[model samples]
Target: MNFSEVNIGLFRLVNDLGKEHEQLNIIFTFLAEYMVFLLAISVICIWFTRNKESRIMIFCATITFTCAFILGKVSGVFHSNYQPFVELSDVNKLIVKEKDNSFPSDHTILFFSYCFSFWLFKRGWWIFWILLALLVGISRIWVGVHYPFDVIAGMILSFAVAINVYIIVPRLNGTKKILNVYEKYEGKLFQPFRKTKGSKTRNY
Candidate 1:
């Protein structure tokens, strides 16, 4: 009826994969976390490839990521703690016991945030990231920390944030200053949009 039910069914599907090997399990978790950073970085790079709209979404990611990290550190003390390690047997019943908090999932936030970035940039390219994003979401439950609901919440939150940034932000036109800067470098790399637009490329 609700999101958790769907997550329960979803997580159950891959419950078998958790049985493979300890090494593989760790690999899944590691990859999930790593992929978030990779996609986040890619979003930042996209600023120059497209236009003002593109860069705005990525800039939101940079800000969101920083906010998440800072909040985790602050929240980690009371609502959460340092999870140094996890054992194999505890994989099931991950949500009720081991993981912290139900409202927001850092992994979900991180995963969906990146997913939104790529999806906006190129739908085809976005598909690959989406698959990787789901895999990463499952890995959290597979390793025993996040519930399906937690991931869903995170993903939903991330999706909303990205959408708001990409769509609503532009409506404000307050982003014009930054968009102008990005538009200037529509075809270059590692350079600010402003500088690229200002440079002379050929003889007049």
Candidate 2:
């Protein structure tokens, strides 16, 4: 049918899937909630490394996250789409109800924006980050708080923001200056945590 009908249909399909098993519900909910923490930890680890590539990555991610957040907030002002649980009669909402705009899922936008920004640079392990981002988006729909279209829009906007940030950040002279400063001081700041070369760990 039309786009709204399609949205409802997909929402029903995945929302029902969540109701089929308690384990799936728990798994999806956990993924939606905690996957961002994993991404944050990754950013922190990358920040500590302080190499050129890591510097560029963290910079792009920082811009992407900021743009995504601003766009998400602005989207709510223009289009306030209600949650599926709010509009539909029977929704298996595994997560807590949210009354905010659902047109573009904020969680999806933030995580996917970060993951996609990194993937634009590094081509290997970032693939897992992309998949994790997809899983997080799907989990939002599965939990019945977001319509499929909401998640899809979030992904589309996130990719757009990430690509723009990736392209634009490297061209700025200030980026190089800040990165130089960060690299210069990173070793001193983390000296206590730095491991010696050729150090061996004892096995218990």
Candidate 3:
């Protein structure tokens, strides 16, 4: 009927979903927040390890996620459309206004960027990162801060950033550094994966 009525109806629908799938919602939120922590540690780890490929990868992930956060904040400021996920207590609702801008959720960006970065560091971890990111993306919509379209947009942006990093890292001056280190250890580095292992072990 009226706008307020529509809003109330939507809120009730979302709240029902929260009640129905609270466990999934909690899991996604935890995964998203944990990425923030993991990404920070990854930065320190890369800086210490300072391998050629890792340096480039860490630089890309940090820069991309930073840009993503800035973009989300900017969009939140410029766009108009604020919706609340939960029914805040009357006092809290009175004190703070809801945020606007559903496009390109910062949460999604944070998850995907971290996922991509972790994937680069250890390819085996990619599956875990991807699944976690997927759950986080869905949670944004499930909890009602982002529209499904908004989450999709964030995913696209994250994918673009990751792909660009993949393509451009090689062109950087850093690629030489990575290659040089490998070159110096060519016999060991270039050997096939199977042979390189067990070389230190006895035949028996």
Candidate 4:
């Protein structure tokens, strides 16, 4: 069989599980839909920490995601497919999605771009981010919104961008300068709330 046949068969394997086990459908549905908001909140919280390392990590992640997103769009121009539910029979579609190009799943691109950047920057306890990315990719397939090839293509594209961003961004003098300028303004903005020695209450 050709690649498209294999892609559909793999999608069927994952999507069919939702029909057999109702409980997993709920989990995968959440991962497919709402987990992105959680990831966004986490990134914002990390940025507010004002720690240089965390800020740099966030910068690298942002750049990685931007580049990957552009690449995904470009790839869509060349190759595009509707969602699996739109193309195949007996799809276990769990979420509401409009009919559009589903090649190189956008969710997969987004999660892997940021999560893999997190893994590269903080290797210890942050490894869960990689697992989270993988689950999100699978969840897209399990929800019947994407084919296996869509998710796989996204993973490969984001991983390549993430690795390059991690290597190049940190070494750039402009990255450091931008961080320093932002931190300078940030410190002033929050200065009134900072506690002073021998003062029980903050100035603000």
Candidate 5:
């Protein structure tokens, strides 16, 4: 009937699954907690590829994440809720989280911000990234660290920010200039490792 009721119902549906299918708790816990490090590693690998397009995509994702993070903080200030485990009885809580404003799940905002930007930039593997973001959001609820509405709010906010960043960031001349300057220094640093023009192959 009310939004709070609906939110709690959805949270129960997902959180209870961990109780019924205890095996899945491991996977959901990983998604909820450790997947962030995977995302970070992926970003670093992409940036080190020395590919211009990939670098630009990473740049856009970073900007989207930063903006969404700021917005999420502001949203938290206005609307806040404790973790579901703290508020509800018999919650299938799988992860430890500090009691604080759990509204607009920070993990959800973080994953959706970067994942959506990756989806927008690299359409070829769009489903993978989007699905990953979705799973992370759901996992937060499944682990009893967030309510459904908290994850949903984060997804909505990050989706909007991702779209705007994708539309606006790449088109700016300043973006190109910054990339160019960084690449210039990068090339200088890696110059010794580069093969010279018309160099003879050295016998191993």
Candidate 6:
């Protein structure tokens, strides 16, 4: 099958699966909406880690996500793709229909960009982050809003931006200043990772 055919077939399969159970719909919807907040939680937790490396990586991740979002927005202006519900007849849309461009799933880009940042930096919990990102992407598809190629494109963009961010940020002269400021106030937060009994706290 051609790429577009496979994409449509996968969308139909997931849409059909979504109809099989209300519980599954609830689960996937939750993953699609709220799971992106894991990025915020991750950054907050990493801030209190008191590990200089991880703290620096979080700063890089911030830049990565910002750039990824802007890139997605610019792509939307140049390349338009309608939501499946709008383009296709009788789609089983589980989420509220969005009128915005759907060529590169924004939620997928957000989730995968943050997760790919961890992967690029060799940070902790990258595997978990990747799995969560996958779930969120699949949920977007299952909800009948995004095509499979949208998710794939989001991931590809995410990897490119994330890897470059991790690599380029450390080399920038301003990045060292930012990292220094971050480290200066690092342990002022509730650092649960500090040693309590002479043993280093485990990195989450």
TM-scores for all predictions: 0.60, 0.87, 0.59, 0.93, 0.93, 0.83
Compared with the true structure, the alpha-carbon lDDT of candidate 2 equals 0.84
Q: Considering lDDT, where higher is better, how would the candidates rank from best to worst?
A: 4, 5, 2, 6, 3, 1
Clashing pairs in 1: none
Rank by TM-score (best first): 4, 5, 2, 6, 1, 3
Q: Give candidate 2's root-mean-square deviation (CA, Å).
A: 3.7
RMSD per model, one decimal: 6.8, 3.7, 8.2, 2.2, 2.2, 5.5
lDDT of 6 at 34: 80
> Which scores greater on TM-score, model 3 or model 6?
6
Off by over 4 Å in 3: 1-16, 23-25, 32-35, 67-80, 84-98, 117-124, 174-204
Off by over 4 Å in 6: 1-3, 182-204
How many clashes (backbone N, Cα, C below 3 Å) per candidate? Answer: 0, 0, 0, 0, 0, 0
Over all chains combined, what TM-score does candidate 3 have? Answer: 0.59
1-204: candidate 5 lDDT, tens digit per residue: 998999999999999999899999999999999999998998898899888888888899899889998999998899888999899999998887889889888898888888898888873466887899899999999999999999999999999999999999999999999999999999898776675532445533
Q: lDDT winner among the candidates?
A: 4
How would you encode candidate 6's per-residue C-alpha lDDT over 53-122 as one tens digit per residue?
Answer: 8877878877887898889888878878898888887777877875868988888888887788888787
Superposed by TM-score, candidate 2 places the C-alpha of residue 29 at a distance from the truth, in angstroms, of 1.0
Q: Please report, in order, the local distance difference test score of every candidate based on alpha carbons.
A: 0.60, 0.84, 0.61, 0.91, 0.89, 0.82
Instruction: Give the C-alpha lDDT of model 1.
Output: 0.60
Model 2, position 136: C-alpha lDDT score: 93
Give the lowest summed-lDDT range of ten residues in model 5: 195-204
Give the winner by lDDT: 2 or 6.
2
- lDDT value, residue 122 of candidate 6: 79
Per-residue lDDT of candidate 3, residues 65-183 (tens digit): 77666766666566535444343221111112256555567778877876776575553356777887887776665555655555666777777777666667657786677656755
Cα-based lDDT at residue 108, candidate 5: 87
Error of 1 at 82 (Å): 12
Off by over 4 Å in 2: 184-204
Question: For residues 89-198, what per-residue lDDT tens digits would candidate 2 score against the true structure?
Answer: 88998878757678889888888888897799884388898889999999998888999888988898889989898888889999999888867787677665555432
